[model samples]
Target: MQKYPMTKEGEQALRDELQQLKSVERPKVIEAIAEAREHGDLKENAEYHAAREQQGFIEGRIQDIEGKLSNAQVIDITSIPHTGKVLFGTTVSIINCDTDEEVQYKIVGDDEADIKNNRISISSPIARALIGKEEGDIVVVQVPAGAVEYEIDQVQHV
Candidate 1:
């Protein structure tokens, strides 16, 4: 399997989630299964079936998180030198050339990308367009709606 780039925060978040699943969720499911078993008649036991299904989902998620954590290359943005160029883990402020509206986004790994939080994946069209570009540079990105132009106003490593 190929390794993927991830922010340090993203890696830690995944680890924390995995820990919760294993330490808290797994034990809760086990107890639920035990309680269901005591009721007898497993063939028609709805609680038992539901508990088993939930266990399967929790286990699958735990494995997925473990795999992602193992393959992650955590990048610490704070350690890098700020050169005013758009790079991974850099927070970029941009102005829509047409509307002159300002938008800020933090370029992060795929796992950490949340539009509501203003965090974008490095693989996203906007981030791809901004990568390697410096502040005051204008970039045109091809989006599903059409091509959009943005001017890089500032770049900060946080």
Candidate 2:
């Protein structure tokens, strides 16, 4: 099994979801299935089928979360001593050389990548290009939109 690199917060989020699914959703679905079964014929019961479908979905999600948490490699960004280079879990400030627009992004795991939150996946084109590069270095990232140039302004391990 390949280990997933994730932040502490991402691991906790998965654990919390797993707990909710097992404790709250699983029992609720069980109750629903029981109530629907009492309604009579299994062949023509819509409620029974619906409850069973919901049960499958809930169980699958529970298993998925459990598997991820079990094989995850948790990383705490604040503790590492980085040498002024962009690294995993480090936030980087960059400026588009051509457009001269400034933007900031924190390199995070795939599970925690949220563009709206300024978090990007380590495997992303921009992140891959920025890694191991220090401040004042210019990087060219290949995206679907073509090659874009960026100058690193700062790298913070926060």
Candidate 3:
């Protein structure tokens, strides 16, 4: 019963996926299995085996999504008043102290993290260092290359 912290959009995405799996994918897999069964010999039916494997994967995903949704603690960042402090569901703008490169990242739940999209997981090293820090704070993150210093420039709720 571990609670999962996620933004409202993240929770909705997971719910949408669960709905698709149960309503569309589950039925399609069941239909495929039935069709494969009509072919007769169960011992030598490749279609049947493939359908079964697909069904297993679909069912597992459905269960996983359901579990996460049930334990989700959805946070609406827009509804919360911004205090200039870095927090979950907040978008943070940081500047590299050494390289002077500026970047923005939205702190999100583990399942919704996409580095390419500028969304980072709360458990990540940089996010961990940024959490609870206020704008204008300088934080150091340990990367594979070495320790990098970043200055927090802005914190946005949107």
Candidate 4:
């Protein structure tokens, strides 16, 4: 089984979602299906069909989260001493060499990557280039828009 590298927060988020799906969504769907069954005519029961479909989705997601958690290698970055080097779950500050714009991104697992929240996947090109590099290092990343150079300004465990 491939181990999924994730931060403590990422693991907690997945566990929380799994709990919600199991305790809340699963029971709600089961109740809905039971209520729909009382309406009779299983052949033309749209509510029943929709409820069953939703139950399937919730169960699938629960299983997926369980599998991920079982294979997850949760990393508590705060437990490690900061070395000013970029690693998985570390927040990085990079300055654009071309536009002189600065941006901060927290390198996280694929499931936790949200660009809007400044979280980037470890497999992304920029994150790949940033990994193993230290502060003050200039790294070039090849994106769809072409090659972009970014100077590593800071690396934080938080």
The digit string of per-residue lDDT tens for model 3 on 66-154 reads: 88888888989988888989999999999999999999999999999999999999999999999999999999999999999999999
* Cα-based lDDT at residue 40, candidate 2: 93
Best model number under lDDT: 3
TM-score of predicted model 2?
0.94
Which 10 residues in a row give candidate 3 its minimum summed lDDT?
75-84
User: TM-score of each candidate?
Assistant: 0.98, 0.94, 0.97, 0.98
lDDT of 1 by residue, 1-158 (tens): 88888999999899899989999999999999999999999999999999999999999999999888888989998898888899999999999999999999999999899999999999999999999999999999999999999999999998
Per-residue lDDT tens digits of candidate 2, residues 1-158? 88988988888898998889999999999999999999999999999999999999999999888888888889998788878999888999999999999999999889889999999998889999999999999999998999999999999988
Q: Give candidate 4's TM-score.
A: 0.98
Instruction: Give the distance in Å from residue 129's predicted Cα in candidate 2 to where it truly belongs.
Output: 0.7
Q: How far is candidate 2 from the true structure (C-alpha RMSD, Å)?
A: 1.2
- Candidate 3: clashing residue pairs, number: 0
Candidate 2 residue pairs in clash (backbone atoms < 3 Å): none
lDDT string for model 4 (94-155, tens) is 99999999999999999999999999999999999999999999999998989999999999
Candidate-wise lDDT, in order: 0.95, 0.93, 0.95, 0.95
* lDDT assessment of candidate 4: 0.95
